[model samples]
Target: MSAAVSTILPIEADQSKPAADPRDLLLHSIYEPDRDIQGLTARELEIIFQAYKKKDLANVPVRKAPSYSEAEQSALELWRQQVNHHMTMRISRYSMGCVSRQHKTSVSPAPRPINRTEHQVFQIPELLDLILSFAGPQVQIRAQQVSTNWRFSAISVISNPKNMETFRSLAPLPPVEYGQLLDDTTRSLPEPDSQQIEQFGLHVDHMVSWWRKLYRRRYVYFPAKLAQRDDLPNGIAQSLNELDVGQRHGDYHGSIHTVSRTTDLYWLDLSQFQINPYFDLLFSEKGRMLHRLGRWEIGLRSNATSETLVLDDSSSEKLLVQAVGSMHITNPPCRSLGIYCYDNCVFPMHGTHILLRRIRNSNGIRVAELLDALQSCAPQLLTKWVKCAEHLRRNVTETGHWVDSVWLIPGTPRFRIHLDNCDMSDEVSYATAVWTPEMARDAETLIGASLGYQAHITRTAYMSAEPPRATKEGEWLPEELFEPMKTECGRSNINWDA
Candidate 1:
């Protein structure tokens, strides 16, 4: 049989479902109702009915010519048209099958693969530079190790000092200065305003001069009493000896230890050393009367000068304040042998313009009382208190305990503020107040009694090339600060004749 005939053979019905009706199937598949079946007269229907009644209904041809006049011509026309359409569809399907078979049998040339010669990107020096520019320093460095050609490109880029500066500038930081600040020209500037000085509660010029003296000295003197603290470290002598090594080499130094960033504020950690008494406890007597020379940390906000203050040893009970600035403080090197801990305290400045304080339980003083005492001693810090009031009030109400303190020095607007909690307990509570001009006027309301106390303020100005992160040992000061002295000493030790 022909392929078309074989394709038209009846399909086997699914046993899972009911068998289809042969009569209905024959009517739809083989007969057109209007022309071949329904339009037929009674005699034609009888013939079709007899044909469907047969056992081999699948083989029966329902196509028939009606004898009636209404269907005689119409039936012939529809039969011819239906046969043409069926033949056309079969022919078209057969043609498509032939094409598909040919496609499967036919061989097509393998697709042209890309050739390296077609696009030599690496060969182009300009293109390679463009690509390398987008790559990071480490990536470029690694690429250099890959080939001599890559080495040339990387060296050309990195060896440029401007490129090095570009990488250094990626981090937003203040300019770093080391050594000392000796600007005789600045001393000749106009004197500070008298009214402004009174508002600051101290002569601004004297304060500035005192700070300059300390900055130039690169030394802080702690009182002999603080050296007597029971908690003082025994290895202070070793640390001082190490300092002497730098000093002997004429290496500039600062009391500043570590400088790092915490959010928008920059934290400056100062070292507390006793240049006088060999052994004095730092921050002894729970910070009551002790000169309490230890590590002092301060936070700096924007528009800040690089001036940093140091707590120097003064007379029996006093710690002298001195301002030190520039690169002298940021570059303290790693000491191979020195005192790890001195009789020192950690009074950190940890705020930008606002002061945050965390309250805990160990602090014997209540939050309110501490705030009151602070207000009495430094009424000038009223602005910080106002800014911290809401948080303080909320914490006090919630925990029924207070342990936060926010204090700011008066008149020293350039001096940064840090907020911290009293170290009485582990559970810390904190708050910040919004200080308005009105709040300054309302400071009297918050203070029960004015102690009329004044804290000597000194502002030191310095910037670091970059913010140093805390090391594994929690040391955040860059080691480069100590490198100059070591470098100079190494040069001095060289034997030219040898």
Candidate 2:
């Protein structure tokens, strides 16, 4: 307190009075009257304040805060708008439902009316980058609800292909709450007119019927043991004439039936496909869109890199829809499957999921006789792999044969895909492998047993659902698999010198 306040003598100074407890003092101070009380002048209070706190308060210097960038200011303003909108709705609701409208108060001057901007803020893509960077799923939904303009801008920015070549679209934000929340339209805008809806290329009148793939190719290697597992594809390698199935390369080495399909990509063709195929989408997330490669069609490197925006949810407000399709391929002989072999090749006998040949290395064995030995000895373990021309669909024959082989079967599962296999050689499934230790051990043993120097085992896995991927690989290692009992034995061990 002030010096004057401190100097005030207590009433208890009189010997005639009994000492009072703090509680009694407080009660008396609140309820009793005191006529002799004195007040300090403002000047006296200042003097006391200066004497006690001059150095701490008066001597402290003030510094200007750093200014926000245009983007930052825009982000702040967007959030401010959200708060204002939410509060306005809540107050309006309260006024209608709870407050007594009949009550009147003294006349007061009316507040000034707000003058909103003539142009919509959401029409600007540059502004969207800044706003989206600061938004979460909830905030995004709010933006979508603000007006048609905002909804279009947000979707356009996210669907734009240019973002990725620097990466936009939720890079800084948390994942969108897809499937959990529906897009809500507030501000009660009248049903959007044709011009507004056309701006976004969304169809509210007629829903699209079919989506087709731009192209398709499939590869199935021999040793398609349907009897091996009940989970295998039914129509694979069944000698169908219209289906384009059967072996060309497998005649000498091991049977490899290559199936190619060029058809309208109905959504159903995807899940029922019997072979391993490279699948991709060509949808334009911002406008007219949605396409997928036929299922069971082997993926080519050309198909790997796509420019289309991927879907996260199916929201009419956000214009999103989910697409998924995959078949069980027991032993997929296609590119990017099991051991990741190329197209048009049969697995040579022995057991080789893949053959890593450097630019200088020649084909070790005649491609014709390779699959023959293994298929004859262990037809049950026939692996489906790819054959490559020095270069196959591309002009890189020089480096075409050079591949990074990561997985094997008949041994413990390895890597992210488990490098594990189903029972059938050409089995294609729509389910993703959970990849347990048991799964890993089973594959390792089978692979460890099947391959000789000539031995090769590449287990292929196919799933139509999205493969889990992270932008930055965090702390993780492949699950540890038990070592096969005979780790160091293969047909290559049989020295021809014998």
Candidate 3:
């Protein structure tokens, strides 16, 4: 009656279903040997308990010398052997991961768009003018360099998004080109890239020059005939008006939005959004356009110079309540707001460079401890995806047809102030520390709450949880189990017997 044995709940058997093949279950799972039918052997269960919990099987005695049976002794030996083997495997995996990351490219400044877009579609003066107006990566730095028509296009798109189909238009994205990025070694990884980096008296002139350039029209390329969109942030509107009225004094006031991750990483970290693959309206012209934008490749580049980054004003942004209009960004007043490393096992970020931008309380000892706590959580990238599945299903269900667009939630929540504060963190700390079943469950929680991500669990854990469940036709819950669910606090006139 020790805690280990007491904590392990027994699963009810499916009396109507055929027994599953142990080999098949083993083939599909790395850790699990389906405890229902193709169940764990005595040694197999012990191996898991020892490997993860550092405990023997729930049924096994806490102390095992005199009371041990021959089978239990064998199981103990097998557990010890398996533990050694897995430890070696873990070391090997970590070594290989180090080598692999060396070859992987970190964020780099992107290739500047050509002086003029020569694609056949943009050759026409009218079409080129309109396409250039819509923002995001496609419009690029060429926006300011172009002719009057180019100026007109941006104004057109903002006034009415009906012209934004080209921006939302989807096609097979080409492989990313990494050849021509400007590598500023001084301002690179150690420097923290942009705005949130500079602190104290050492960089006053730098800030002055930077602000001077921004006020001098070198920063924003706001259009002349601008008709404000309905959803423009109030601060941005004030900034725009200041830019207009303050034009003569060379004064500029504006709200600045900062983002940390590169664009390619944006769509990949989609747990922050609710995407419905099953929406019927997605097939329609408008819905198709909106959905296509969700799939659009925004490219691989650092957000360093992307001061122009704006949320697409899609339905997804509405769900996120986007405190600030950017991805993978924690807003002010949140600890680790500008900090972007989640230490995801699957898609870990290279964040030593982000320390360059750590502003405010980041220098304090308490901040370092928080940083360590964040690292210890070591969230998997797709945990949010699995967690977001319920949200997506609920959103779609509540919306009930007539859906027009997908949604992105920018919920870059703070990590728990204390490790014990997160209920799932206890199991997740172990799971994500290496790998385990709870890693999958905690992944979703981490994504939405810690990282601005959402989506599904890994195939292994998902399959283990959902293992090709089969049931006889018309099979229902057992009568014994069903009877307990009949208890109700809410008033109901319906008969329970029926």
RMSD of each: 41.1, 35.2, 24.9
Q: Rank candidates by TM-score, best first.
A: 3, 2, 1
Ten-residue region with minimum lDDT total, candidate 3: 465-474
Residues 1-498, candidate 1, lDDT per residue (tens digit)?
A: 122222321335323333334443344333343333323444554555455443122222223311224443344344434433433332232233444566578896895663444247876777776677667455555555445566566555544444433112221222211111213221111343546434333322333334344312232222212221222333442232233232221112244333211111211122211111101111121221122222222211112111111112222212110111101111121001100111011111111222222222221212233222332323223234223333322332332100111111211111221111222122211222665666544442221011000100011111101111122101211233111121111011211111
Q: What is the TM-score of each candidate against the true structure?
A: 0.16, 0.17, 0.18
For model 2, what is the C-alpha lDDT against the true structure?
Answer: 0.25
Q: lDDT (0-100) at residue 17 of candidate 1?
A: 30
Candidate that would win on lDDT = 1
Residue-level error in angstroms, candidate 1, position 127: 1.0
- The per-residue C-alpha lDDT of model 3 at residue 332 equals 11
Question: For model 2, how does the per-residue alpha-carbon lDDT over 53-105 read when each residue is reduced to its tens digit?
Answer: 32211211112112346654454345434433433342232131222332243
**Evaluation by lDDT, superior candidate among 1 and 3:** 1
Report the backbone clash tally of model 2. 61
